[model samples]
Target: MEKQSIEQLQKICTQLRRDVLRMVHAVQSGHPGAPLGCAEFFVSLYFDILRHDPNFNMDGKDEDLFFLSNGHLSAGWYSVLARSGYFPVEELKTFRKINSRLQGHPATEEGLPGIRVASGSLGQGLSVALGAAQAKKLNGDDKLVYILLGDGELQEGQVWEAAMYAAHYGVDNLIATIDYNGQQIDGPTEKVMDLKNLKAKWEAFGWEVNEIKDGNNLEAVLEGLKKAKSLSGKGKPVMNLLYTEMGYGVDFMVGTHKWHGSPPSDEQLADALGQLEETLGDY
Candidate 1:
């Protein structure tokens, strides 16, 4: 993939935000908060960081791979994947619709060009990523494996088990990131179940940890990703704690969990569109 400048990537982020809002609103269902918050990360990964082929294959040999553990962010991932040429951007209109490849959560049954496995059932993405990373190592494929997880999903015991396994087995080719937006479907993660001192926790689990304090900033996300990549192949898995607002970009949606799974009304959608500039044109 061709590398993009920070300015260009930022523009893509705006378009992705618009896409997420519209996709969710069109179905009047689907989670939007995490997708809105994660626009920068998704754009930076697909457009700049990932050494991937848009011509998708399940084997993923000799190419960097990404998995979304927090699958509710499907809208944003679908937009990035489409814009990056994994599938037609026009298909985005059918998101969450009946029999559409773009399901509410990413699934492989439709053979979605970009998705490798069924996801959205939280707490399982890391394990899947670890398996892929270990396979790459076994095949002598140096490309990295990346996965994104929601901070709220950390409440799941499986994440910790996977964390222990990654470090114990020295899965140095893997990089896992937590969307530390602090909000989930119910309320604040801290209120629902506090993930106190996440950096300390990951480090104690024997992994190299990095953080992006302003995850919404495109430049910051890019820098953070680069840093995480640098830490790879050092005999331990990498973890990036990315702090972002649950609902970013749109003013009304920002800073609240209410929009986590709620689609905006017609007027709200119009207002969100007004806030986001259509940089690459709507799908």
Candidate 2:
């Protein structure tokens, strides 16, 4: 695929945001907050940053690989995958439906074109991404590995273990990003379980850390990803602490955890579609 201009990427993000709202509202199931919040990141990665092949190969021999640790955000990932040609865009309508490849959480059993492994268990994607990164090294493939984790997921002990392992082994070819939206299924992360000073925490674990203060902004996300890639292959894994709203692009849903897994009502969906432009047309 040809490199898209920043303007083009922003338009894709708008379209993707629309896709997420419709996909979730269609089934009245699936998570929406994180997906809407991470739309810019997903669009930037797939359409601009990643050197990926949508043809879908398990080995991923010479192409960049991405893993979604916080798999509840599958709606946005699936939309991006389809829009990027991993599968038919029309298949997005079947999200979370029986026998659909687009499960609530990404799975490999159905052989989804863009999914390499089942996710959504949280605190486990980093471990999987680390293994893939190391395998690439063993196979003499220098392509980078990327993973996205929710900020709330950092509370899990397994995440810390993988963090330590990656840093200890110098998994520098990997770039891990935390969607620091600060809201979880229960409530605000601070009210639930505060993740104090995340930048300091990741740096303390021996990884290169950077922050994108406004992760919802397309330009900021693109720049942050570029910086993260530059830090790769330098003997330490890179971490991007991306700050975004849980329910961005939707006025009523923003800043709240209520929409984490809640699909919008018919009226609510109409309002959301009003907020997001129908760029590139709906899937």
Candidate 3:
């Protein structure tokens, strides 16, 4: 890709991180850490990798689909979609309210653009994305399916089941990424439930796994994604264990699971915004 494209994507990622913080802090409830952590990955997919239209239709027959298995990070998804022109950015403030389309987790039944399936229960997104990939193949469409899962969420049994199914069935059109941020709600994933051999586990399941050390780095994410795309259609599903800092970009929230699901208070929000520029202006 061109330098200009990389620069643009980096800028967009920064702004998306800002939106994730601001929106979560405003509501005083939401998952900011994961969103901030996965900002670069989401930026790369929406602006560079995924072929999607801003005015997305519900059918999604022609567009590449993205499934957020760890749906608690809806703030990041909403911010990216809005910045990418999927919908009005003004609707972000209505997140988690009584009747807003932007809920804690995404639901297609709510008529939300850029989200095909409702996810929040965790560990189910890969299966959903795999099913979508199968549908794409049946229709003879070459569009790819992308799904993001949390490292802690990997402890779920269903994830491996889906992984085995995808590989055994030769679902080569899917690319699954793990936000290996090392932290989750209760504590570190290792402490909660040791994932001593994450890489080995994916490989054992027959996935072509790649690792990116710094998921917060936009350029690195783009390059890694390009590599993942190149490895697609190789008879095995592609998986990337993206190393991210949970609650990245904000010093206070970084390196801890405390801010995983809790929103920052007003003062904390002010502090966060103070640290981050209003690149696209606060909505």
RMSD of each: 0.6, 0.7, 1.6
lDDT of 3 by residue, 27-134 (tens): 788889889889999989888888887788765787778889999989999998998888899998898888999988999877888888899998999999999999
TM-score of 1: 0.99
Q: List the residue pairs that clash in candidate 1.
A: none
Q: How many residue pairs clash in each candidate?
A: 0, 0, 0
Candidate 1 lDDT at 33 equals: 92
The positional error of residue 164 in candidate 2, measured at the CA in angstroms, is 0.6
What digit string (tens of lDDT, one per residue) describes model 1 on residues 129-241?
A: 99999999999999999999999999999999999999999999999999999998889988999999999999999999999999999999999999999999999999999
Mind giving the per-residue lDDT tens digits that candidate 2 earns over 1-283? 8999988998998899999999999999989999999999999999989999999999899999999999999999999999999999999999999989898899999999989999989899999999999999999999999999999999999999999999999999999999999999999999899899898999999999979889999999999999999999999999999999988999999989999999999999999999988999887
Q: Candidate 1: which stretches are off by over 4 Å?
A: none
Better of 1 and 3 by lDDT: 1
Over 4 Å off in model 3, which ranges? Answer: 1-4
